[model samples]
Target: MTTMTTDARFREFKMPDVGEGLTEAEILKWYVQPGDTVTDGQVVCEVETAKAAVELPIPYDGVVHELRFPEGTTVDVGQVIISVDVAPGSAPAEAPAEAAAPAAAPAAPAEETAAEPEGRQPVLVGYGVSQSSTKRRARKEAPGVPAQESGAPAGTYYASPAAAAVQAELNGQAPAEPEAPSARPLAKPPVRKLAKDLGVDLATVTPSGPDGIITREDVHAAVAPAPAAAPVSRETTPAAQAPVQAAPVAAGARETRIPVKGVRKATAAAMVGSAFTAPHVTEFVTVDVTRTMKLVEELKSGKDMQGLRVNPLLLIAKALLVAIKRNPDVNAAWDEAAQEIVLKHYVNLGIAAATPRGLIVPNIKDAHDKTLPELASALGELVSTAREGKTTPAAMQGGTVTITNVGVFGVDTGTPILNPGESAILAVGAIKLQPWVHKGKVKPRQVMTLALSFDHRLVDGELGSKVLADIAAVLEQPKRLITWA
Candidate 1:
């Protein structure tokens, strides 16, 4: 039988590591599906790693042939999630006998080329695979098994268990029956991990994703206990002394359990690590910020600060920067591995922002070198990007010091925890009009509290005290920013 070969027309696209050595990402959305024409550099889907949300662009132009995984599925790097037909409209002389096999297969190889030319497949974001590591040896087919009925395609490395079962059926051998469903529950790796962590059985959970796939929400809902029954109202009781029966409570009405993953998961892990590993010491001081508030209003109308976000946080960030300048020793990290205290010359000023994802601290690269207006502009961009959930992993790294404005939530001063690897964190409380002794007379003044938390291993009480005092001084007398800086 003559079989036309059109496999060379198809090309597979593997999931690329979007960030620094990330292993996997959850498919947030898909922009294209099978038969959709896509061009070079066209975004195919959005994926979320532990760090951030990233959109992936297709490298070459083609008509999409298959989507291996659906949305909300977390796929590992180097796994083929998509396949495209580079030559979609090519005519074939004869169709192969095993044409129905590829349709039923979940992971069908696109090509059967023996050798991989150097850089034939381009990896996204400059993370390329080695030329020698790109190709795999073909698996030997079992006796009496057709070429397409083999466990895997020629030169293909990976084959799932489901693919193995398909091979058995193609060979006319029925394998042993399964205890649960005929096929295993459809779920990604991370969702499986979450179910395992929560001690939930995937087979017992009702799947809500497309094609009967289990989602993260489904896993969470599986373990959610039914709400407690409400007490019977006394006025509606048939008899005052009769036994009371509880009213039925609706599901998920009283509380909600949000599964911690992605950015929130990373943040929670980092916070727990920082709290236990580092020896923290927090110092508090209430200061009169009447001068700083006035300065903020003045900078708003100034030509230098035009079109900038000038608020108490702006002046407060500047104040903290000036304080760091006064005490450079406070800008250091404790290297436990080397048993050394590494002091930083440049300061990446971190601003803690709360988003729908979670709290993220994105920092300005070098706040010490920037002018007031430049600092204001950088701060504006940082806050805006963080609020929109576009803060990249690189933006949250290498921070020397941080400022968390709890005042925005109308909170008094809090004992802030030190961000991992950073020396200190400053917490700013709400600025309220309070009666205070100003110029030896009682008057209503703009007052706020400042709390400084630092790693005692690198910053002693004396150094931490000086840094806190300098910040307080800068806020009390705004002119001290120039003198201290």
Candidate 2:
């Protein structure tokens, strides 16, 4: 048998759907650029989707040949963004110039030479090279002046078409023929839009991109020029000038507008959907959590929970889990398509965390099987990761129940909206000292309010009340966690 070697070819990497059914993602940053050698499973770029920031890893080892899109560009799913040469030693594919050179005469015009097709190979999955001929839009040139000068000044001269035509008529010369459109500076659609919006001419802006392409930074720099001193005016003297009045400020002048793109957009859409689709019934209960607070202090000093997050929220989470075990029917979802109730045997408990980006719920998988210490550790890690904005999309999916602690913000209580696809959500309020009737007498006790919101379709008033009552009962009597759980 004879062994044969294949030629080296370029491989294109497309932007993948990072999140569940995500259609697009913004390129946050690129770790590797062109000519950078990358290995398999090495992260090359970071993209921000509607859910979270995701780091994309290259699938194979190769030398990067081209980067199709720059940073901050929003690319659609399955669009090719990067190309790499897998085999560096092999000869590259034949250039189109060599094939077209013989067909055209040796003295062909520069326009014909510039119009040759770029025969690039299709290397991305589900994408192929377009077979149609590439045509360039004709750029309307000034009628009088030529595109280039034989000997001009050091700096390149650029003028508007109207100005050039006016100057040519004054010089008493006929307008020169237009040049090829390919001679114009190269730029992406977004960059051209930015230049137009900033009132900056692309012809006067020097390009800093690869292959003489114009970039956003180049356009911005052209718009912001160095300050020059204004000439002193002798016509209007300071003594003869009249007093000027200050104009009134408009409304919302100091307000800043932030674009809704990533996690914030997803959160807004989910809240609107949940509020309209589900019949939300919220019930409030003011409970005495003096025992629960004392238990939190004891656990903080315990050897098992020393380094973990030991707080009222930790005990409250355990209490809710215990309550779920008592009332398993509450841990379910209503399937509209199937017209049935989907009850989950396991619990993926979600904790609503407020980060700099927005509110995100990262859940602890299999919370029903973990002990108190394990639960505390998981909560600690979840809070830490959420604060750093490193929570993955998988951590935010498939949650059966969620807990939003408004107490941290000093809020008394709130009717929290249910997370999408979840059956119930619990809100914990600020714990304060208040006089309550205990043992037939009014005494000072640590009291806190709990709000439970549920879908009325799946959980009736009785079942929802039972779950909330069970949670309050466990918090009031801390020993029930051991007996009920």
Candidate 3:
């Protein structure tokens, strides 16, 4: 007979890149109190990175052993979130260990009862992928009932809540029956906002991979679309067609409250710090780049550029890279503590985009080294990922510089804010066919405005102007970009 050794096993659930190829995530909230029994696939916590808010599930059926973080701490990817001691069955109908504790120590003083094992190891933040043994629960349903496929689902199920919610969006689902448990999520403030923006209904989305917890994906699947509502509502009544609806402000109601979460919250804090400390000095210059528009059209048709989006933004990104190469100082930052200008040898170029999750800045690492095609692919991927509200914290972090495409909104220009810890943010305004003096003669041509918001402490008016001029010059004459490179 072979001798067997007894050992405590562990499951380290890493914070996964939930969406937009994230690198890091922030702990938004913890739902499962430590020492509470958690079901396999139960939602133990909620997390928000740059893209979206997700409810992370407990992957094992066990006793809640520990919680590693507080409600609002930021954590890196692959960090442990929670720990489970795993009882043979669901957290023994009652905490047998606690109840049996007094008997084991009848001689001990009652004061020691205060120690009641409250400070056990905690689950980690960012996501509830923690110390566990990934063992599954055995199903409880008759084989004929399809709902019982995964042991006992963390909670009861009815006509899939997500399906019901999406059907509600279609303007004609029977109201939820009084007997049914609400499909609403138990998410915190940040998660609620994320769901709202994605058009996802929290109530119906099924939770998998966690304690019967609904995830952002569950919401997505719920809103996946029954069909588009008509552009004009045919069911409008005379009261509904009033010039404006009154804002309801009844007792026990909330109004005009903004949540500090995800990209919006991060951006707010960063912008505030940058604004107060950096001594911002914004200057603007309008150039008639008729030739730049011509080149944009030319490149769109080029065989070499095949399947690429050869637009003003592409040219602007390329131009910024070129300018940074020429003027390294403008690409650098002010390190007040070191009292030195930190000139980055590499450029992790950030692109500030407006997504369903609010405004996000997802950057391309080593963008200065990427080719045109590579840059194109990166841009496409970033936009698509942001649209899905899946950008991770990793992608949003470590950005040396950034650019914002305000032009897509048909705006002429405005002063942009610098991302915290970074030296500059470039705002690309709309290109319009405005009549202007070409060589001193009024004529119609495509023109755009470029707003470069840089850290005045690092980049002075001279450096900022030169950088803007370089980018504008490239847009004005594409040939200058080749030679400037």
Candidate 4:
């Protein structure tokens, strides 16, 4: 039995689980290709997981030997993706005994080795040997039958139906016919979902991906409307009777399709789960924020708030924090599995920021302990990081309550959805100047609308109303912030 062995100078790098328990990541781009030299801690590629986009760095120095997969391919964790030659200038080093043992040892039964090999090492980050025996198996020839149905293993990747048919004829057998209707097509889950959404049949679409797998492009091509046939008129004149052909439709002129993955996909799933799993109740209140608006301008010119992001959001976030302090029950989460309500003592304030990738809520850790200036600084950093798309997954976890500034977009107000695991979300509308009745007289004053959405299971109507009222009260009279604290 022949076994494959690699030179000791060659080292393989496997795709790592970047986030906690993330099983796969899509290779977005590669910075270096084969034959390029690399050093330790150099970013070799960027991958997008369900959480966010992240760059991966190589651990050791070497000359690139090979790249197993191309860009845009989704790779599972613990799969060998790239190899490098560590000792480039030196002669080939001696292969380790264990690396060469498969070739020297007696051949074991096929069932024994296929099921599970003895002494296999556990694959972990930055450690473990690449398994050499897991290469693709050879295809077996069968007369007048497709390779997949002729004892090939389930989920085996095939070249193409045409290639299989040609090979069957060369082997002195009749060419294989088209795959049966009952045969399942090979496509990724996301591609299948896309096809289903567009009402396209995957079986009829041609396969352009490697190993006879259908791709998003192939499905789109199958569903794209054909140019309209020429219209013929029944008339006495010859010119009217003749048919006239229409010009072919240009690609992407009528519609465009975008494949959803990574952050956008995760956000959609989370919003659906949060909306369906928890019973949501929304409360709205319109308040005069003339004092809060004036306070924001004053703080912008004040010495204490200088060089910080001083705006209405700063005070609005502060108001919510103080409100949560008063109504501590609002700062809690429902433990579905435990069937209990876990009340939190500290606040991790979530700020819902809209980014190009999607909407992400990155919260300030332990926001209750922060002073006014410190809170302003944290808000500035969080907004900047999210807009730059550099927010990490850890920055988004453990948020007890959230605030979304829909006011920035000029919207009047909206009933915002709760972020998963959070108890409530506060929406702030545009602060517009309007005529209002104040001091028994009508006058122009700055007014804003606020909407609060909460999970009804943990927060009763009385508790939710109290939290929202406290926020509105603080915004209307700015001095309440100092007194309430």
Q: Number of backbone collisions per candidate, in order?
A: 0, 4, 32, 0
Q: List ranges where model 1 is wrong by over 4 Å.
A: 1-6, 92-123, 126-128, 135-255
Q: Residue-wise lDDT of candidate 2 within 1-485, one digit each (tens)?
A: 21222212355667765555577888888999888987756788888878777777775556777788888888887677777655443334343223322333355445533432553322211222221222222222223333332111111111123223333544676755433323455554335545764577899989897556676668767875312111221222111122223345678687555678888899999999999999999999999999999998888798866556577888999999999999999999999999999999889899987765677888876788778887776776666656555677766888999999888767899999999999999999999999999999999999999999999999999999999999999999999998887
CA deviation > 4 Å runs, candidate 3: 1-46, 49-255
> Candidate 4 overall Cα lDDT vs. reference?
0.71
260 Cα displacement, candidate 1 (Å): 2.1
Q: Which candidate number maximizes lDDT?
A: 4
lDDT of 3 by residue, 168-285 (tens): 3344454343234332444323344346655667665655524344544455456642222112212211111112224556798766554556666656777788899887777777
Q: All candidates' lDDT scores? A: 0.69, 0.70, 0.60, 0.71
- lDDT value, residue 40 of candidate 2: 59
What's the lDDT for candidate 3? 0.60
Worst 10-residue lDDT window, candidate 3:
233-242
What's the CA error at residue 281 for candidate 1, in Å?
0.6
As for candidate 4, its clashing pairs are none
